[model samples]
Target: MNYRTNPKNGDKISQLGYGCMRFPSSATAGVSDIAEVKRLIKTAFDGGVNYFDTAFVYGDSEKVLGEVLEDLGIRDKILLSTKMPQFSCKSGADFETYFKKQLAALRVDYVDYLFIHNVSEKKRWDELKSWGILDWIQEKLDKGQAKNVGFSCHGSTSEFKAILDDHDWDFIMLQYNYLDENWQVGREGLKYAADKGVPVFIMEPVRGGLLADKLPPKAKTAFDNLPTKRSYASNAIRWVLDQPEVTMVLSGMSAFEQVTDNLTTASEINAGGLTDNERSAYVAAAAAIREFMDVYCTACGYCLPCPKGVSIPDCFYYYNLSFIDDMASVKRNFAGFVGNGNISACVGCKACERHCPQSISIAEKIAAARTRFGL
Candidate 1:
């Protein structure tokens, strides 16, 4: 378990923090299997993992973590990181209400690292502040209920910059992976936060399981030629660790095998870990994957000022994924754009395509989305 110093508060954090979102299901239904969750956490701790990240909505994860850690008698041995759901702030008083509930759920009096959960859109933070939730958090911090204050963001770089300037945070979590280097905050946002002295913790280091599947036939040859040895997952994880701006990379491990595999890579690796040539192999591989996605849609939303309220980039992203690959994220991404005046509302207007520099033929893509996602 290699560790890095939190730039703001200087607390050492393990580079491979355990995310508790995907604990194995109990009935093979939806409920998380506590016994398996416990074993995985125990194995992680025994193997030197010290960061345990959970949230209120991860379906009994807080309770499972609390029980496991208490049974192991290692409450103080690891960092207890959880989030306060921003949407829970109905009033200033609800802050304490929700925070206390989280404490009870986790069976802990104080959280080592607490964040404003999932600040994906700029409106999320604003809505919370309108209800005085930020003030409530500060009060809790002053009262020692939360040791460190921060947020986990999925918003754009500009929004993240504003949030960094708006508050003094001990750490910040962002969705960073090999594929998303140019996505939100991408490389620039990461450096911006690091320069401001905020320790950056990374989530979704593998693009939410997009990189772990059997390599495409074209790319398998390149991976097979590697010298030192690596799996597709290991190489992807190593790429994130290679970046200097990232303090820790969080992996949501549901299986003991995953825990074992990740621990081996994380324990042996460090900053400046990958060689120049090896790094090139990964970059080349990622390029090949992008070559599979020839759309060149940066997802910049330049085509979004759609008059018909259609989600243009979103429609294309899902359409491509559903037809071209079996990745689960495609369906997940599609679901979000289904309601409202989404792709189904395209109305065959080529106005958006006219504005698109990529000349993507927006109406055609929307028709494709209708067929692909059953819209």
Candidate 2:
């Protein structure tokens, strides 16, 4: 696989890092299939993907990754990266508590990359600082428990800049995709971090599977007209890798096919790999997708576990899909997905909106879904 060197520490991170957030789940229940998870991880490792990213809040991701890598006896063969659930930290000691648990979960003594997760606002950063997060990180480094310290951001470009300037970050992660070139830290934040010699890792390169599947008809036509036919997913990923500043692109592959496709793309592509014609195709496809989208939700699921039991992301997904695909099929699937918690159950609590990184008017969107679907 193609690899890029992190300027800060000279670590050769794979161009395609395996994101462990969305492991395959059994159809009977939401439980992850451990055997399938192991197979996917083994495939990625055997394919030369060294970076495996997980987090505490990813619903047993860390534990499962730890178990799989250990069973495969390839923990040392890969770089283990995980995050501190900053939102769950109430005190300084909690940092150590959570980190120790992470280490234990991974069954590893040290992490290759440890990040303060989702440092989206200055207020959160300041709170973390007050809790002695910097010292805690230094302690981890000194003890060789964490090789690198960094953060993932989901805030305004100004807040992103402030956070970058506030600390000596070894790396930075952000939600970057062709559709979000001017959104949330965007190209400007990317360049800002790169200029300061900080390597950047990209998350949501496909906007949580939105770009890969459910393509707008116009967008699919744009790609279909291209001389070299590629999956919409490949186009989205290549668009990100076209930038020289991106150190790695993380894809949360839930299926074996996705793992295989991403591995091939990562191995063949390089910095500025896209040709002029290919770039034009992406530009056209992105425009069409944007024109077709109603909510712009990435389906990241951050605004989840709604107090009112509403499936906010599902509501938005079906609403958007209704426009691009057959409305009857979309509605049928939406019925099963929503089950008892339809959009009409929304109570206007605005709790989901508070956590949404996109700052989408989630309650308003739910209302729109009810109207569009005649729920």
Give candidate 2's TM-score.
Answer: 0.97
Error of 1 at 71 (Å): 1.7
The clash number for model 2 is 0
lDDT of 1 by residue, 324-352 (tens): 56646667656765552477787886877
| Cα lDDT for residue 305, candidate 1 | 66
Off by over 4 Å in 1: 293-370, 373-375
TM-score of 1: 0.79
C-alpha root-mean-square deviation, each candidate? 6.9, 1.2
The residue-by-residue lDDT of candidate 2 on 1-375, one tens digit each, is 999998988988899999999999866465778999999999998899999999988988888888999899998888899998988889998999999999999999999999999999988899989989999999999999999999999899999999999999989999999889999999999999999999999999999788886788888888788888778898889899989999999999999999899998998889978888887877898898887688989888888889887878878878999888888888889888775356878988898888899999998888888888887
> Would you estimate the TM-scores of all the predictions?
0.79, 0.97
